[model samples]
Target: MPQHSPLDLAEGDPFGPHNLPYGVFTTSDEPQRRRVGVRYGAYVLDVHALAEAAGSAHAAVLSAGTLNPLLAAGRAIWSAVRAELVDALTDPARRVTVEPLLVPLADVALHLPFDVADYVDFYASEHHASNVGQIFRPNGDALTPNWKHLPIGYHGRAGTVVVSGTPVVRPAGQRKAPADAAPTFGPSQRLDIEAELGFVVGTPSTLGEPVPLDAFADHVFGVTLLNDWSARDIQAWEYVPLGPFLGKSFATSVSAWVTPLDALAHARTAPPRRDVPLLPYLDDSAAAEPGGFDIRLEVAINGHVVSRPPFSAMYWTAAQQLAHMTVNGASLRTGDLFASGTISGPRPEERGCLLELTWSGRDPVELPTGKRTFLEDGDEVTITAWAPGPDGVRVGLGEVTGKITGR
Candidate 1:
């Protein structure tokens, strides 16, 4: 009997030809040499090899070890290369040449797809922000005054961003409780996870120029699953006047695969109803495209599904976030990363973090392993998501997972 071809993926496979998410990988045979590849079914197609073999004009950009070159190559080149890849993989005549370049996913080690230029995380989910407000300030309003008007975000440490599967060391920092007389320093007792989606910037902008809402696709290349690990105890103590610092700086994990923005056309939807009128820069009322995505995210602890956060419920969309991020003339750069903060929904089961789901330790989540209010040492957290694709298919965003280690 003949072996099945990798190209002949089963119908409705998320990572089929329709979803060619890019990544960087290295094989044991050449562990030192990193190559750019695309996920197809359970195999990693060597895109550089394919481009070179086909004598394509965009071969140089794909040949690079990292995706920076290709990311910097603007939207036109990106579309052209993607078209070439689809034609090559789907054309039966080209299968003989393409088959040899395909490598088993298990045989390769995936790495950070690009060198991160900068990282920004946005508190765009109304459900998440409101829950946090109610948890911390039960007597006050659930939503902040500025919450409905603008997309709130903070710059993050870019160096600490890691690819999926990286082990996270439990962060140690100062913490204080109202009952305590003074602050104490030790490993965080309230370690938590924030399930979100991250947008990757491709084309850069001038230093003092602001990227507009319509240019979102021109600047952003793709999306990925992001796990912005948090230490709630430290954050609670430090986040006043100033935003998250040490609590959020320790580490941020992102998926190895980047699902290009073009693949998510079918997933685009209008953002949730807005009660407040937005300023001209942040307003999307006249935008040509629907900014919200219909992606559904799942959070898992030790392999047990916990929450399902809907990205469509987010109040601020990525386009709005980008517009607001650069409203002050902040420039964009290739490989710049911006996350959608914690994605949550109106339902209790849709909360994105343990801080909200467990209500700041007032409640504990029951798991087969044990009860958990906060992540324990050796606990593993994984976030996965998928969006609707053309023809009823699903575009998988892969996953970002990390296991916590004791300090």
Candidate 2:
């Protein structure tokens, strides 16, 4: 709807022309965390300050006790808040409105924008699921029988979900070597990153009351890049009947900003092929309403460039996943979190994670300087996405980068 394109965007810039994601941040100098601002270009704007200054325009939403309360109020308030910020931040003529709060990205210490009450990560990527299953199942069935029918997921440890820039410890677990014959307890040798997008819940639903597929988007506050780091070696031994535990629970990295769908609504595209007809409850009209977006996602290693893949590769749509999630009437809180399973492309090189790209290290990925079996200490991983819309005021998911460090 807004455009400042060609001139404003630098091709792959995530905060350029179209995207405007919001996050909670305070200057590093601040002692406490307060829900403070939105990310635009390379800076954080002070929404809270804007409220104190604008008085009326910001009073409806920004003046809230906190951002979480505004999020719980749902899209109406979110759209209102974002619109106010967009008008104030991008318009040079609106100097008075823009003067209150502005901080360079470097000056801020970002925190989880909202309190995450619970987390559920979905394995809806067909290719990701098929490939991962083959590693363990080998024969009986490639996908779990119900996988095709519903969105498969695992309850994640919400307490460990941290904002981006948080250091993920190199996990310690049991690794079995053929020579040893028995498992050896040690630090994970296969610590890897999974490039994923997570959706945040904006409102709460009543328990035992199913959320209709049509109403799913109304509850989604926004989206962010999520790195569900994996310790494959440890996972192989621990995930027998129950799914991931410690191996997957240590830490998760997410972009500081949560891009609201309203701003990126113009970026929506259609969902990929329907492998199987969805059940009525799982069937959603929104999934068909340009359910996909042309957001181009990319990864970089230690500042070196990696391939950029599109979000369109996902076969199952996020709307379908959200709709299916409520079929059983599981109440989602105002700040619940959900990750789209690792997004991988059909071609081997386009895969999202090192685990898939390197075929579990059997084939190492060739970087600019050389090959990589998995992430090495000192290596940095950055994930970013953006799309163009009317007027070129492109909407983007700012770079979500993290550097690997020794244990």
Please tell me which predicted candidate would have the highest lDDT against the true structure: 1
What lDDT score is found at residue 19 in candidate 1?
Answer: 85
Query: With candidate 1 superimposed using the best TM-score fit, by how many Å does residue 49's alpha carbon deviate from the native?
Result: 0.4
Model 1, total clashes: 0
CA error at residue 92 for candidate 2, angstroms: 5.2
lDDT of 1: 0.95
Clashing pairs in 1: none
**Cα shift from native, residue 282, model 1 (Å):** 1.2
TM per candidate: 0.99, 0.89
TM-score of 2: 0.89
The residue-by-residue lDDT of candidate 1 on 192-295, one tens digit each, is 99999999999999988899999999999999999999999899899898999999999999999999998898999999998999999888998898999999
Tens digits of lDDT, candidate 2, 228-341: 888888887887799898888988888878888876777887766777887787665444466666677787777665556567777767777777787787888888888887
